[model samples]
Target: MPPIDTSIKEHLNALLDRGKGAGAAKAPAASPVSTALQRDGASVDFENVIAEMLGAIQDMETQLSSVLEINTLLETDLNQAKERIRELRQEREKLLSTIARLEEEMPSKRELQMVIDQLIEERSDAEITIRDLRRRDEQVGAVLKGLQDAQRALEDSRAQLQSELAAVEVRLEAALKDCGKLETRNRALEEKNAANAAAIKELEADLRMALDERFRLSIELDETRRALAAMQGR
Candidate 1:
């Protein structure tokens, strides 16, 4: 690209020299329109120089716009790079935190072995207990069956005893009725015996009076016979 300052300076110096030359030379002054229309060499040179300066300015403006566009692109790239670096740093910190946490949480080999051994021992003990309990449960089931059979036997015996007791109670009730009848009969016999005793006493007293009367009669008859024999002898 051409330099803007140099081009402008050269054009201005040429213009100034033309003005000085025109002023120094004694020439008839022409009207502005005539001189412009004449298209003189100096006028034509000045117009061409102005046209070149304007073209140079336009070229400079285009180059300046391109430089600005490139600068803007570079700034965008730099900002993007800075943001990516920041994200990477954050990711690094997170990874370091994760590593530290894992290190703290991880168990030692000895501790893991101890836990495995304890689990094995517990499993063995549980198996032994399960076998013992199963055997005991079988024995208990057998005993329960025996108890149930004995209870059934006891129930049958109780039913038989109740039947026998019912029979004995019936016999006892009949015996009680017979005893009641005997007591009544015995009371009647006692009353009859009492009446017979009173009659016997009265008959004994009558027999004694009859015997006394007979004795008196016999004595009287003997006395009468003795008197009669004495009279005859006389």
Candidate 2:
């Protein structure tokens, strides 16, 4: 297609050139009304062409302004999109760093579960140990009670023995007092028997002296009787 300006100029030059050619070919006896009509037709054609050209130019200017506005809006949207993508990239990097740091600080799932299981087992063992210790404490308490009972029994028996020993000692003291009295009585009887034996020895000596005296007296008496009887017979 031709340029709007160029087409308008070409159309106008063609009408002018046709007018010149018509004037040269026509006789000078052309009517004034027909000439006036020709000039009016030429002017109308020029005005129509000019109006079409102006309308086309105005339409082009309006289309160019719309395109510029659309381009400006598109550029603004593109720039905003680019800035948003950059922010997203930075956020993604920060999230990746956070994930890496957390991974280093925390344990793996399997290892953490194993540690928890071990802790549970340890708690179970501690509970069992506490139960065993409580049982042992009860046994020790029973043994201590038994020992206390034995001690009380031994103390009672000792008290009983002490009472029996006191009674025996009292009986021995009484018997010892009786033995002392018997020894004193036996000594007095022995002294009395000694005095009686001395008296019996003196009596025996006096009886022997008397018997000899009697015998001497009897002999003398018999001699006298014999003398007297002899005298009488003489």
Candidate 3:
């Protein structure tokens, strides 16, 4: 019975060794984890590893979602900036056009101002001339009035001289009548004293000549005075 028991134990040991050699001879499996589980009777910690991998995948998906959201925000901001730039460009163009128009109009505006200033100066000159003309008219009117007064004075003097001449002519006529009456008396004495009668006739003729000369001189003087007055008026 002891030999039989020993033989059975040796056979079991040999079979176990043969199994290990066969496993070693075969190309090693790709994974040692599979051999370790079979030899060690260790259960695969699949639950904990799978949970850690799932957690990592979940964290990666969360990070991707955050990246996508950030890219979307940046795109929105870029589009907004583009629109703002476009508006700014448009405003700049409008301002430049306004400046160009103002520049073009500036010279014409200056010319218009110059023309207005010239017109103002011309109007001022015309006003000054008008004022001067009015003053000259006033002076001319004053001179005309003075001339009219002098003419009136000359007329008065001529009238007075004419009246005096008429009175003198009447006195000469009366003296001539008295001398004619004396001539008859002298004729009667002519036979008695011819020399004395001739002397009386001579004296009467001289007095008549003197009166005629006085009248002629008075007429010449009046004419000369009127000519002088007209020259002064001119």
Candidate 4:
């Protein structure tokens, strides 16, 4: 037995011995007076002796009852101790199983942590690339806007030039029509001048003929007058 159990047993035995000693000490004490009363054939004063015997019996009974009560309490305590030991052993086994499981999973937990870190790094790099692409897209949009503005300006210039060209074409057409009218008028005037020149030449020839006739008549008149004067003188 364990030392504690041995000690408890020793204590119980001591209690039993103490109870026995108390009982033995309280045994009936016989008196010589009572024995003489019995031998003289007279009635012994038995009341005092009887009272002493009854007291001794009651004392012994009290001691025995005390010992029995102590034994019962010790047994109850021992049973409770045994139940506590059994529960402690079960709890120890459960703790050992949990520790073993944790040990088995340590390497996998480390690997998972490494994978998470790598994924985080990759995500950071991707975010940087996305930012760069957005900047480039903004630059391209600015360039496209500039090109659209230039195209609009060029179209406006072309429209203005076309309007001016249409006005110039209308003016040229009108000038060409006026030139044709002037040419026709000049040709008609040239023909009329030629006809007037022919008419003037015919009138000059008739006037010269008439002047020759007048000159002949005047010479005849002068001859007649000279003949008459010769006659009168004869």
Candidate 5:
């Protein structure tokens, strides 16, 4: 932000003081500001006020820019998490397929009894392999469940971020609109002040003419009185 020009404030104050001084020196006349300069703070430093507002808006935008960058990173993370979930789901499907194939190839109870009698050791090995497959399937199921829960959490976080971003955008828009309105109001005040200045000049001129006329009338009255007193003495 640029430094505020204190000179403008000083100039405006000087003008107001001068106007007051001029009014006090002359006969009482209607004030132009009381009637014509209706806007608030006709003598206030509006430029400085506007500059401050702009600076605040710039700050807000900068902060929002940072927030946007953070949101982008979070979105990237969300995407990565989704991809991981997809891969896990694919693995789970493959595991299920393997389990289905193994079940289809397994022997019936009567065949198992016959195989047990012919190869008891091989049956024990088959049992152990089947138990391991079941345990692996359970592990895959647990992993998939955990991934689903994490996905839900990420989605919730993303939704919150989106809501906050939307609100910030709304506030930024409102601030900009307010800035435009202040500019319009400042322009209107400048025009009003200009018109008031012209009117004051004309009023001052009329006052000077009136003062001159009064002075002339007073001199003539004194001369008439002197002439009458001289005639009365004769």
Candidate 6:
């Protein structure tokens, strides 16, 4: 198998950290994540995070590829082993056929009996060879089974890992959506505040004008009372 890339794990962990405030524990899956992570002008590095996850998946696929290679080699060895066993069994069949034919045709021939004895000895040797072949075939079968088991385990791991990555992606998307909504709300609030400030400035100007008019009226009244006092003195 290709060496494990710990960087992929590290990247995944980083993305998980970014999603932590997405309130995985608090927020439902379909709901938007926490808007707290969103800065005014800053955005989440979603593309980068997803790219790293894809890289991790690629690494897992590479490991599975190695498992497949092992399975292929084992399958080849198994086929060869079975073929050798078949050849041995065929040799034994041919030997038995020869012996049967000889016995039927020449049972009364003296020299033919000697020939039958030699053929029987050869048949025993053939039987031993076939037995050895069968034993080797069993060993190959066991090895193939072990390789198949390993392949299954790798497949399961890949599937689980992919599922987890999918979850992370969902959370990230939720967080992004939350960020967008927050930024919009914040903008609206800022606009409202600016409008309120302008209204306050107009109110303050009106108040100042009212106060100036009152002061002018008091001054005019004082002047009129002085004129009435001067006319009475005359």
**What would the per-residue lDDT of candidate 4 be over residues 16-124, giving only the tens digit for each residue?**
4654675678644434543554487643222333334334434544544554555465556556555555554555555555545544633443564575566555555
Overall local distance difference test of candidate 5: 0.51
Question: After aligning candidate 6 to the native by TM-score, how far in Å is the CA of 228 from where it should be?
Answer: 6.4
TM-score of 3: 0.31
TM-score for each prediction? 0.32, 0.35, 0.31, 0.35, 0.37, 0.39
* 23-59: candidate 5 lDDT, tens digit per residue: 5696533344333433543333333443444454445
Clashing pairs in 4: none
Evaluate all candidate structures by whole-model CA lDDT and list the values in order: 0.52, 0.51, 0.50, 0.49, 0.51, 0.52
Model 5 CA lDDT for position 30: 33
lDDT string, candidate 2, 1-234, tens digits = 112345544654565566567657945543444466467762233334444444544454455455455556555655655555555455555555654554465445576457556655555555657876566556555655665565566556556655555654565555555545544554554454444344433433343343344345446534644564566578
Q: What is the C-alpha RMSD of each candidate to the true structure, in Å?
A: 88.9, 97.5, 79.6, 92.6, 19.2, 31.1
Ranked by TM-score from best down, the candidates are 6, 5, 4, 2, 1, 3
Number of the top TM-score candidate: 6
What lDDT score is found at residue 204 in candidate 1?
A: 37
Please identify model 3 stretches exceeding 4 Å from their true place.
1-50, 107-113, 128-234
**Candidate 6 lDDT by residue in tens digits, 60-119:** 455455545555655565565555555545555555565455445433436545655654
Query: lDDT score of model 3?
Result: 0.50
Question: In angstroms, how far off is 173's CA in candidate 4?
Answer: 1.9
Q: Is candidate 2 or candidate 5 better by TM-score?
A: 5
Clashes of each: 0, 0, 0, 0, 0, 0
Which 10-residue span in candidate 3 carries the lowest summed lDDT? 1-10
Candidate 3, clashing residue pairs? Answer: none
TM-score of 4: 0.35
**Total clashes for model 3:** 0
